[model samples]
Target: MKRSTKITMVVSAAVVTGLLVLALPAMIGATTWVTGVFGAGSGSPAATEPPNPTADPASDDGLVDLGDGISVPAGGPGECTSTAHISTMSTRTDDSGPYYSKLIGDLVDRGPSELASGQALTDEAGGVYAYEVAAGDSAIAIGERFCIDYITVQSHNHVRAGMIHAGNILYLRPDPTLPWVSPYEPFDVQPGEQTGPYYDAIDFMRNAVVAQDLAEAQRVWAGLGPHIHPDARTIATRALEAGDWELLRQMFP
Candidate 1:
């Protein structure tokens, strides 16, 4: 893991802990929008701190890929729900547990505890990349450690350009295809500081419109706008091309 990513991971653990403690109840009481499986969003800078191996358990199974092509490892499950909602999920669960019960170490564990375990960082597709940043670590350095492009890492994680911290978890995975891209292409973006829940909103719009489920699209787009990237454009262009002005106006307007 890269230093920046590690720092992000450590901060993510603390944030999840705090969120579960503070925000879980409100979410449970409300509609509890499904955000985790969608997009990324902003949060405090505290999450950019790197992990301390002595303080953080370096070897644990803190990751579980949701098979929807989204991987939720312990550290950077950005903007997720405190309570799990299985019924609405489109992916199979590899592990299930309450947020509070999960330990800080177990949740942030990247691989196994020892090289002898055969689950060492070397076992990963790319060798385990690790870094340590104090007050001086550049955002570019952090991005390099994690093997993510500077922009994608920064934008997706909601960080300022060229800013990061120390003791972070900078784990890397080969870039995967974004779920909503192929059609939207180059315009896939979140307006403002939008995050996970917004992606759910986008997904809802996508299903309703592209899937030819007009009612569903209408239901979700009730609050959408022209500024919404890619999808809004894709949907509008398709609607206009097909002479479905009603759908285009409803979605883009």
Candidate 2:
């Protein structure tokens, strides 16, 4: 064969091979990613894999272990017997007299003052803290509790000090509204100057508690107990009176 013809054939073959390699990926569709056990065939039911073993609370870190704390099973309510007239009524109001009504009125009026004093108590103990903030939290108090500066929290969440509500999550870093040069550094604030938001947040929480929105109220009240005005004792009292163990646990635990 002529050298030129041989060279031409070799070059054609090389170009065809390169084109095939590039087209191979496009020719085959992307592979499907199947999670868990796939069926043996199209008509077969999915093969059942053994369930993941549940972790024992006693063996888990951060879990309350038996002997360390009483374990309540995750099922139904435990034994709580009420007294006569109602097996669970811890104390019966004497319906035969107007005296009990006055006592109830007095209890209602005294709640806010108690919550205010409760805040002072927490301050004294140095336990004010914030775990998370949804839009419902007092942005100012959250900033104070997490040691995030107030101005930054307000700007990041896009609310004035008093506008935050129950479900706003503020990003500590990369929130362009603050003067913080480094996002990771810890900081603290004096409580009273930026408390309007905190007060408003608590007021909303009080209403929720009164409305029997215990879980919602507890969520709002979760970490702000120290910040709660002693007057909140009224709210707490309502929670206690209503026998809401979960809310009470959040408050006093």
Candidate 3:
């Protein structure tokens, strides 16, 4: 081989090596970029599968376990027997005979029109009330106590599987105009804001006056003692005694 030819070959080989060195880094970088963008090859970690969706609460026949041994059906009352729903009444007790008597007298004077058309007087419907569930209090018992249907109680409060906790506020008397809704959509109002109990008491008094049964009115008044606010009870007691239905109306209104 000629010396000049050998030198030319060496220079060509060096240039080729230099090009390879420069291009190798760019090739590696391109591979890494492709891997990152497309998640190709075992060099990259496998993509995490999207987390499984949460289970729906309405599944499993929509039966709600309200703790205790009780379980009630959700949605509209389905084969819900009143006897099965009723439980022992709450142990709390109350007595305000004179006040009840006076209230009964007032209801007698006012007549059924006042009771029937509660909206006319207070701008609120009659028979709607808020009740905190007590231990052993079932939908039917609460309904019977308030002279309402157990199914109505369950449907109104959306009580699932007859499940009612002790502190849960059950609203009585659903709006007649509104379409039936699922249990997931509850009423917007809180327990304290509900005036149904007061009106319920008044209704019972009115019923007793209509039946001409002072004893029944007194019994209803006693049952209502625990449900009524102490302040409202005091005001009601005074108002009934003083024949100041206007004051009673103000409190209820």
Cα RMSD (Å) between model 1 and the true structure?
19.1
Each model's lDDT: 0.30, 0.28, 0.32
Q: Tens digits of per-residue lDDT for model 2 on 8-53?
A: 2322231322212111111011111110112121111111211222
Candidate 1: segments with Cα more than 4 A from true spot: 1-126, 129-135, 143-149, 167-171, 174-253
Which prediction has more favorable lDDT, 2 or 3?
Answer: 3
Candidate 1 C-alpha lDDT tens digits along 1-253: 2212322242323233322221222111101012222334311111122223332332354445432122344554333223221011101122121111111111122222221112212112222322233445555444333323334333333233335544322222211111112112112233455445554565455445545666665556555534344433444444434545323322321
Candidate 3 residue-wise lDDT, 69-161, digit = tens: 123444423443322111111112221211110000000101112112111111111112344455566654554344334553453344556
Winner of 1 and 2 under TM-score: 1
Give Cα distance to truth, residue 90, candidate 3, Å.
Answer: 35
TM-score of each: 0.21, 0.20, 0.23
Name the regions of candidate 3 deviating beyond 4 angstroms.
Answer: 1-128, 176-180, 184-253
